[model samples]
Target: MASNTNLTPPRGLEGLDLLASAIIILDDDNRVVYANPAAEHLLESSVKALSQLRFTEMFLNADSLNAVFRQATENLFADWRQDLTLERSGREPLHVHCIVSALDKPGMAILIELRENVQQLKLDREERLLDQSQANKELIRNLAHEIKNPLGGIRGAAQLLELELPERHLKELREYTQVIVKEADRLQTLVDRLLAPHRRPHIVGDVNIHEVFERVRSLITAEFPSGLAIKRDYDLSIPEFRGDKEQLIQAVLNIAHNAAQALAPRIAAGDAQLIFQTRIARQVTLAKVRYRLALDLHIIDNGPGIPPEIQDRIFYPLVSGREGGSGLGLTLAQTFVQQHMGVIECASRPGCTDFRILIPLP
Candidate 1:
């Protein structure tokens, strides 16, 4: 479809871009004035493509739409809300809860908003994740600290006991003391790793998301030189945001590394594919705070998906899908992202797994 370049985006409507709901504005003649990013995604068309398109030309059936539009414009303050079905490409029907209200603007401006049926459920899940993240952090900190304090004494006691042993029995006793000392040191190291993210100071800098991707890409590509194909579907227009550059790199690398390991079977078949996809999300809400734009970065892999039983607990410490895996990779990644007021979400099935990292854009 050819775009209508003659139509320009309306002024004083920039705030509309910050809305989570899909919004469209129409002129008195029923020509589309503007379509927000959410609206464009809902309609499966861009603002430029939908611009200046007459109401009848845009929809397969315009009778109901016209009636609702008229009902809304008749009374400026009376907003008409109803469930409506829109035909897509003449086959698929999209069900939407639509609200048409009159805008107090020149030329009989009408504002139409479309909302997804599951939007509320999605928001509730996001809220739950944020709350759960907070609780998990506190629990981890207390648990790590509790285990950390006694470790030094246990190791020191083992050394003292070893030195006090008699010469003839020293060889056998030394072996026993060595085990205690080594095990204590191992546990101490584990505790330190658990507390690393929280203990380290966050260093903020202007981070280009693509640079982070490149660093991860280089590491994964070298690790799996053959049989695996790493693909990039990046939106180069994503603006640089303030974050800890190294933290972002580690967060992405952990996800990609997990993907590479899961792709082992596919790798042997020489058909494995890992994709790094990035897009700019408009009007993002994270941890109850809303931002004008956010980064939607996806690490997708065509490998066996996460097991159903442990899918929800993947972010928890010591939860591993692979055998002998420490499972701290994703936990640390989540911590690092959370430090930046961002979140990492996972969606997995049989053939595809998508790990999304969302951060508010600057």
Candidate 2:
């Protein structure tokens, strides 16, 4: 014998809280009835704080979202708008996809789902960068091999010609041969460096990012001893991760060295500064993989920032912002970091420049 009473569904929204997309429940009057954890994170407000406000209060242009909500309620179906802008005061407006559906329960008339458009853009950008890096590596390797073969033969021929020249009357001519040999050697070294990242075996070990920073600080201070000040703001709680120690050192050194060169005038005037900051980032997505924890290392410099004209292509091989620069330092640094499953990003202005490195932590 079964009871005649009907069983009611659970009133709490515990299931909605598990979703990565932001979820907001609204009452018939459009006031917020519930907000999940993802919604709290997206709004930068707690669930309790959000519940006190109406849906229209959270955005500058709420009319568009409201229109969709009205249609969904009237039709008794779900509706969604793509690339809708949600404005926040004192912050950049966010582009989000808004989904609205009517709920059958009382006091929860509608369910709204918000997904950030920037996140998809980030994923696409990472995919493009990874593809570009692979193409660059292949091009460099093939080009370097072609150049290397001719280089050895050129040097050998130059030396042989010098030995075969008339000993008594060809001293001045011998100098030309010597010049050819030196130039060939220089080119050979350049080719070797171009292929270095691919040829070198990765050495794995526990790496303290702070240690790498300290090493770079010491080296940079030694070179520009007088004017530049190196500052450290470290989050001591960040645990060590595994990586290639020497490669990390070289990657950071190249970036710091480039900054030092950019700060030449300020360095001479005794006012240059470089800051090394380390912190732990939570819920970060890098190279299409979401990480629970990632190491955020920022290298900040107080100097005339990167010129706006060439800012976009700074990481491309042979694209130097400074005159006489080979433009390979940053390229090599980007390669090394990418090999460690990390990414480097830069933000520059007239007086401040920041290079941020993000690597997942185990």
Candidate 3:
């Protein structure tokens, strides 16, 4: 943190230091006239050091900033750039949304506000996802109810029709009835599975995220015993939180199972790998609420990534990238996590796919 005791802040901008957004005031020459505390933190430099440098030295996209500053100063209006990439030397580039406005003060010609675009996008996406999940759950519940009653009747009618057929003369006819009965039963099972999460009462208990990972790992390993390798990188310091242990286990299992299935080709060639990593996420905003501490659990797979066409909708019910996939696995997992007041997100490329589940700690 930078000390403001020795420096005199510009007039009419004394409150810049109190803002959460990084703010920097620039002179007509595009030099740093003032840098707020948040700006100092964001630039990884103290106020004194930043004051000695030009605005161009602070950001790689200095030209874009200069353009915005020129426009604001000349037009005396506010201008903004969305999703601008700010390059830092020896550091990763930051995606930011910047706002520039003419300061209308001597020496301080422009006020620049920079906000982390990725974090804002994540928060916005999470809000939409949470809303979509709730709507999907309600639809599933209603659809299950509409299908359950008729399915039982169809199965019963098939059984009765089978019994009516003569044993020897109509054996083929009886087999047809058997097919109807079997299909009806299968549909019934599907309906039950669709409603399973809502049907069960949530059972809360102390949940160690590592235990959930271990259970999922054991299950996935047992199923794909030959080629795939399951790796664990855990943060044991993470404290236990309140959740339904069984539900969490099932949620993680679904994700790992999906990854294993996706890694089938690599597994055949003996190069498939699944990693379970855990860490403590600080100051995370999940589902619109900010949490000081959250558990960040990642299930990473070295497999062909999720198909781009369906990647965005992977969490929706009945949306699958693979053939004959029910697509309920991710939906159920999302619902389970939401029940625990958490959120899950994914980032994927050609060879690496990461599914991150974040849950608030007690």
What's model 3's TM-score? 0.73
**Could you give me the TM-score of model 2 versus the true structure?**
0.72
Runs in model 1 lying further than 4 Å from the true structure: 1-116
* Predicted structure 2: lDDT: 0.85
TM-score of each: 0.67, 0.72, 0.73
How many Å off is the CA of 199 in candidate 2? 1.4
Error of 2 at 227 (Å): 0.6
Q: Candidate 3 lDDT, tens digit per residue, 201-287?
A: 999988888888898888998999988999899989888888999999988999999999999999999989999999998998887
Which tens-of-lDDT digit does each residue in 119-199 have in candidate 1?
A: 544566678777877887888899999998898899999999999999999998899999999999989988888888889
lDDT (Cα atoms) of all candidates against the true structure:
0.84, 0.85, 0.86
Q: State the displacement of the C-alpha of residue 303, model 3, in Å, after optimal TM-score superposition.
A: 0.6
What alpha-carbon RMSD in Å does predicted model 1 have with respect to the real structure? 13.2
Using TM-score, rank the candidates from best to worst.
3, 2, 1
